[model samples]
Every structure is written in C-alpha cells, then in structure tokens.
Target: MSTTTAPPQPALPIRGFAEFLGTALLVIAGVGTAVAAPDTGTLGIAMAFGLALLVLAYTLGPVSGCHVNPAVTLGLLVARRIEPAAAGVYVVAQLLGGLAGAGVVLAFRSGDPSFDLSADGLGANGWGAASTGGYGLSSAIVVELVLTALLVLVVLSATARQSNAAVAGLPIGFTLVVAHLVAIPVDGTSVNPARSFGPAVLTGGTALEQLWVFIVVPLVGGVLGALVYRVLRGSDSDAASQDTPDPTTRAGS
Candidate 1:
C-alpha cells in the first residue's frame, strides 16, 4: 500500500491570524473586565487575564504557539525558536489585535451615560498619578521588569519539552495571574505591552504618555528571561550527550 504525504500549510498568514485573534481575546477578557467591573477588585481582574490566556493557549497553541503577548513572542524570538520575519508578523498582529479588542470594549462602554473617558481611565497602565496604589516611576519600572521576566521565564520553560506541551498553558497562565496579583496595585500589571497599548491609545493622557515604560521595559525583561532560560536549559549538545546514556554501566544494574 502507498501513502501520500500532505503538503505543508502556509505558516505566516494563518499563524498571524491565530495570534491576532488570541491577543484580541486576551484584551477583551482582561481589559474588558477591568473596565466593566472595577468593583470586582484585583483578584477578579487577575483571573480574567489568566483564564483568557489559558483558553487561548489551548485554542491557538497548535496554530501559533499562542504567543498572544508581544513579550512572550520576543522571548521565543530571543531563544531562536522563531524566525525574525515571523516574529515581526506575530508582534504586528498582536498590537493590531489589542487595538481591536480595546475598540470593542470602548464601543459598548461609551453607551453607558456615566462613562467618562477622562475621569474613568480605560484600564491603561502607568505609574504616579495613574497608578492605583500611587506607585512611583522607579517602583513601576522594577515591578514591570521583574514580573515580566518571571512571566516570560514561565512561558519559555513550560513550553520547552514536547511532553510538557499538553499542559504548558497551566504554568504560563498561572504566572500571569501571579504577576497581576503582585503588580495590579503597583502599576496595573503591564507585563504585556500590547495589552497596555490598547487602552492607553483610546483613553489617552497619562496612560498614553507613559506607554513607553510598558513597552520598553517588558521587552528587556523578555530578553533577560530568554537568556536565563538558555543558562538553565543548557546547550543542545549537552542535552543530547545526557540523553545518550553511559554505555559503561552494566545493563539492568
């Protein structure tokens, strides 16, 4: 019997769309929750972000590795797991997706008579006056850098082995939850640049002005996280040598 092999699917556009949709859903759940229900408090908002990503990971992981966050995409890129061109596409898609999701939230929110864009910030991230806990610039920087690194590290490590693929989303999603739990009161937990960009662009003012912090710091954090992953994972040759086993050992010893 002869079997015919199927042609490989085009990766860029399809994967990019998956990333777009996944990121959009993430913003819709996380930012939307923050905007719609400020009363639910920090844990509710954190869970919103985490649960959305958990579902998106399983839904879009096969298509695009479900890197809905640009920081996560950058971590994969630094690890050399993704080509530069593909990574660019993924980032662009994610930014546009975030904007789209925020637009959706704004559209419905505007209908509310009491919703004032200026008075009620649309879940944009920042420090100082914009911060929920009145955190300073330095505090914002450290929180973003550290928590983003932690988030990127979890994403990198959990997805390292194919055997772990079945549940990689668990740790990744949980890490985001923990990051938010810690940073929500500090600077609204912008481990995700795109997530911050969406609401900031629409809401304007401080969130928009301070957008650079959310963007630049998280990217640096991603690179740092990737490099740490490299150290802990060791070289590919080292992994291979370890897998070869020691022939000098007696069989069934």
Candidate 2:
C-alpha cells in the first residue's frame, strides 16, 4: 500500500494584495478628506469616512470582506470566521496599507506652503487637551470601545445573513457614519487601528505616544462584540447550524 498526503493549498497573494490596496484606499480617501478639508466641519468629515467605507465595501467586500480595520479583523477572528494565521496576515496588510495611504497624504501636503506636518499631525486621534472635543482619555477609550462594539455588531449581522446581503454595504457604511458622529469628538473615531497608525507615523510625538489606546480599546471591543454575536447566534455548541445560511438571507436579498 502507498501512502499519499494532500497537497498544500496555494497562497492567495491576490487576497493579501487586495487587502493591502483596499485598506490603503480607505485610509487615503478618509484621512485625506479630513486634512484637505479641515474646515469641512464634523458632518463633512463623517461623510468622508462613510463614503469611503461604502465604496470600499462594495468593491472589496466580496474579495476580502473589506475589513479595512484591525478591530474588524479581530472581531471576525474571535467569531471563528477566520483562522489565526489568516487574521495575522490581514492585519499586517492593513497596516501597510494605512502607512502607504498616509504617505500619499504627506506627499501631497509637501507642495502646500502652509502645510506643517508637526502642527497638523495629519488628523491623528487623541483625547483631553489633544482631543478635538476636549474629552479625557478615559472618555475617549470608552467612546472608542463602545463605538467599535456597535460597529462590529452591525458588520456581524449584515454579513452573516444572506437576506441582508443586498443592503449590507449600506448598513456597514451607515454604521461607520454613526460611529464617527459620536466618537469623532472623543478620539477622532479611531475604531480602525490601521487608520490610526498612519497619521501617527507621520505626525509622531504625542500622537505616537497615545497610539496604544486606539489599538487596545478597539480590539477589546471587537472581541466582546464577536462573543456576543456568537452567543446570540448559538454557535458555541451547534457549529453545524451556525454554518448554515441565516433564514433571513433570502428575505434581505
């Protein structure tokens, strides 16, 4: 008798590259909007992020789920939708994309006579004296955590059931708008680690010093949201049932 082993699956480099490109687009479009239009006001900035998400979700949602945020990746990992290895890769790609996006913004700013990287900080997130709304770090943390939690919840619900698939992009984008509406004043709405990392790298100093809060809070909230979603869907024990398409799939479609 001869023994044979299954061949390893080929790497999906396209997926990884797609993730990188998609996240870059997200951060560039979003952060760029903030910097270019600092006078655009809160609602305008919110729209920038919301519109970026709406476009990216539709364009990359099918390809790589269009996470664009490390918290979202962690959320899916906690939900067991993605393996640890894959999640790691996704996060790395997202970070690279973020840096690239911020780099693009910096390049553009270089041409402007009044552009001061240190003074502007490229829209970095912060709290208290550094905060746009003068909210304390503690308040900023709470706002980021809760907003990320709610954002993840919307992502989970929209992507899980097939019925809502049609409007999934709409809700996902809108949820971001809502999150920004609340948390922008608190911490510039850094529910996305990649988004935070870019401007910090460019801005440095206090922005870099306070980077950890953005990373920690959103991840914690993501894990909590995933756990809540799993519990509600009864996926802890009934793995088979959990894998089944949600009944509302058709209805939502």
Candidate 3:
C-alpha cells in the first residue's frame, strides 16, 4: 500500500493582517485604559497595558511572534534571533500599528465632555518634571534602562531558547506586567518606542518634546539586553560547532 503525504500549508495574507490588527488593539486597549480610568491610578494603568500585551500576544504569537514593541525587536536583533533587515522592518510595522491605534483613541475623545487632548497628553513618556511622579532626567534614565533591560532579558530567555518555546508567551506577557508595575509611576512604562511615538505625534506638546527619552533609553536597554543574552547563551559556540543537532532529527545526523 502506498501512502500519500499532505502538501505544506501556505502562509495566509491574513497573518500579516493579524499583525497590524493585534498591535492596534494593543495600543488602543492600553492607552484607552489609561484615558478612561485615570482615576484608577498607576496600578490600574499598569494592568491595562499588561493585559493588553497578554491578550494580543496570544492572539498573534503563531503568526508574527507578537512583537508589538520595537525594543523587543531590537533585543531580538542583538541576540541574532532575527536579521538586521528584518529588525528594521518589524520596527517600522510596529510604529505604523501604534499610530493607527492612537488615531482610534483620538477619535473617541472628540465627543467626550472632559476631553482635553493637551492636558491629558498622548500617553507619551518623559523625565524630570515631565515624568508622572516627578522623576528627574537622570533617575528616569536609570529606571527606564534597567526595567527595559529586564524586559528584553525575559524576551530573550523565553523566546530564544528552544527549551522554553512551548510556554514562552505566558512568561513573556507576564514580563510586561512586571515591567509596567515598576515603571508606570515613573514614565508611564514606555519600554516600546513605537508605543511612545504614536501618542507623542498626536499630542504635539511636551509629549512630543520629551519623546527623545522614550525612544533612546529603551533602545539602548534593548541592545544591552541582546548583547548580554548572546554572551550568556554561548551563541558563537553553537554557531561554530560541527556537532550541532539537526532540528528535524532526534539524534546526531
């Protein structure tokens, strides 16, 4: 008896659509939570953003790895999980997705009674007096750098290692929860440059003026995390070793 083999499945264009939609949902839900429930306070805002990431990641993980954050892409680049060209593309997609999400939020505010875009700000990050909790520039820098490092570290370990691939999404999402829990009170928890860029472009005030901190610090932290992960993973050895296991085989080929 002869057996027939099934044809390989072609990737659907809808997967790309899922990427755009998922990131938009993330930004809208996260920023909307902050806007609608400002009185709910920092913890609430943190949870909003965290939950957004969690849901979005699960929804899009199989399709695009759910890299809604530019810093995460940068981290992946540093760890050599993706090509430099791919990292640049991911960052651009994330920024565009974020802008779309923020635009939706802006539309919602147009008819609200208390909607003052200028006063409320666009959820952009800042430092010193610009910071939500009066954190200074230097203090904000250190806090953002450290927290972003931790965020990227979690991403690197959870997603990059073959051992953790099966359950990576849960830990990765929870990492964002933890990062937001710590950083929300400082700079509104902007570990993602694309997240900050969207709102700052819309607000066009201090949010725009202080956008540099949100972009620069998180990027620096991402690269640092990538390098650290590469060193720890013994990446060069894995690449250079002739005894490396073939991914499709259970034993040495």
Candidate 4:
C-alpha cells in the first residue's frame, strides 16, 4: 500500500497572518470589553483577556503558535526556538494587528456622542494617576516586569515539546488571567507590548509618555523569563527540539 504525504506549506506568511489576526482578536475582545463596560471590575477584565487568549491559542496555535504578543515572541527568540527574521516578522505583525484592533475600538467608541479618545483612553496602560490604583513608576515597572516574566515562562513551558499540546491553552490562559488579576490595579497589566502600544498610540498624552514603560519592561521581562526557563530546563534548543513539532502538522495530531 502507498500513502500520500501533504505538501510543504509557506511557513512565514501563514504564520505571520495567524499572528496578526490572533493579536487583533485579542485586543478587540480584551480591550473592547474594558471600553464597553468600565464597571466590569478586575475579574471581568482579566477574564476577557484570558478567554480571548484561550480561544486564540486553540484556534491559531497550529498556524503560528498563537504568540499574539511581542513579549512572547521575544521569549521564544531568546530561547532560540525561532529564527531572528521570523521573530521580527511576528513582532511587526503583532504591532500592526494591535493598531488595527484599537482602531476598531476607536470606531466603535465614535458612535457614542460623549466618547473622547484622549480623555477616555482606549484601555491604555500607565502609572501614577493613570494607573487604576495610582501605583508609582517604580511600582509599575516592577509589577509589569515580574508579571510579564512569569507570563512568558508559562508560555515557554506550556508550548514545550514535553507538554501535552492538547491542554496547553488552559494553563497559558489561566496564567494570563492571574497576571491581569495581580497587576490590573498597578498598571492595567501589560504583559504584551503590542497590547499597550495600541491604546497609547490612540490616546496620546500621558499614555504615550508612559508607553516606554510597557514596551521596555515587558521585553526585558520576556528575556528574563526565557533565561530562567533555560536554567530550569537546560539548553533551549535541545528541549525545543524534543517537543516542538512542524507548524504544518495539525495540532494535537
């Protein structure tokens, strides 16, 4: 008997689109919830982000590993799980996707006669008075760094080859929920730079001024998380090779 093999896939573009769409959906669902329902509180916002990620992980994970976040991409890059060029492309896609999602939210808000992008803010992250709990700059930096680092660590572990791919989404999503729950009051919880960038670009003023904190801290945290993972699991390449599978393959197959 003879068996047919599947054709090779165009790895980059498909993966890139998956990242783009996944990230856009994440912002739309997560930030959209916050904009539409300001009274949802921390748990509601956390659940919004978590559920969005969980669904995206299962839906797009097969195509792009559903990174949807630059910090996560950077974490994989530092771990050597992805090549530099691919990681760059993923980051670009994620940023553009975030912008697109925020634009959609902006459009929706325009429907309201009282909506003000600058004053209302599109769920942009910040410190001090902008922070939900008025946490200071140092507090914001430390909280984002630690939470983002932990989030990336969860991503690295959940997607490892030794992990059960079938169930990775649950833990990864739950970790995001926990991160938001802990850091929402501090700096609105930006473990993802793209997520922070979208609203800042739209809101301007202080959000734009404080944007650096979200971007730099999350990136640093991502690298730290990858390094910590390397320490715990040994060489990244070896572990990644042992568990990582071809992107063309169906997830959980």
Best by lDDT: 4
Candidate 4 to truth, TM: 0.92
lDDT for each residue of candidate 4 in 48-140, tens digit (9 for 90 to 100): 999999898889877877889898888888887777998899899999999999989888988999987768889999998898898899998
lDDT of each: 0.79, 0.75, 0.69, 0.82
RMSD of candidate 3 to the true fold? 6.4
lDDT agreement of model 2 with the native:
0.75
TM-scores for the candidates: 0.90, 0.88, 0.84, 0.92
Alpha carbon lDDT of residue 37, candidate 1?
Answer: 89
Tens digit of per-residue lDDT, candidate 2, span 130-221? 89888998898898888888888778767774444567888888888888888888888888888999889879999999989988998898
Q: Would you list the rank order by lDDT, best first?
A: 4, 1, 2, 3
RMSD of each: 7.9, 6.1, 6.4, 3.9
lDDT of 3 by residue, 136-215 (tens): 77877887788788788777666643344456666767777777778777878888887888888998878888889888
Better of 3 and 4 by lDDT: 4
Q: Per the 3 Å backbone cut-off, how many clashing residue pairs does candidate 2 have?
A: 4
Better of 2 and 4 by lDDT: 4
* Steric clashes per prediction: 0, 4, 0, 1
**Per the 3 Å backbone cut-off, how many clashing residue pairs does candidate 3 have?**
0
The superposed Cα distance between candidate 4 and the true structure at residue 142, in angstroms, equals 0.7
Candidate 3's TM-score reads 0.84
lDDT of 1 by residue, 145-237 (tens): 888888887876666554566787888888888999999999999898889889999989878999999999998988888788788887852
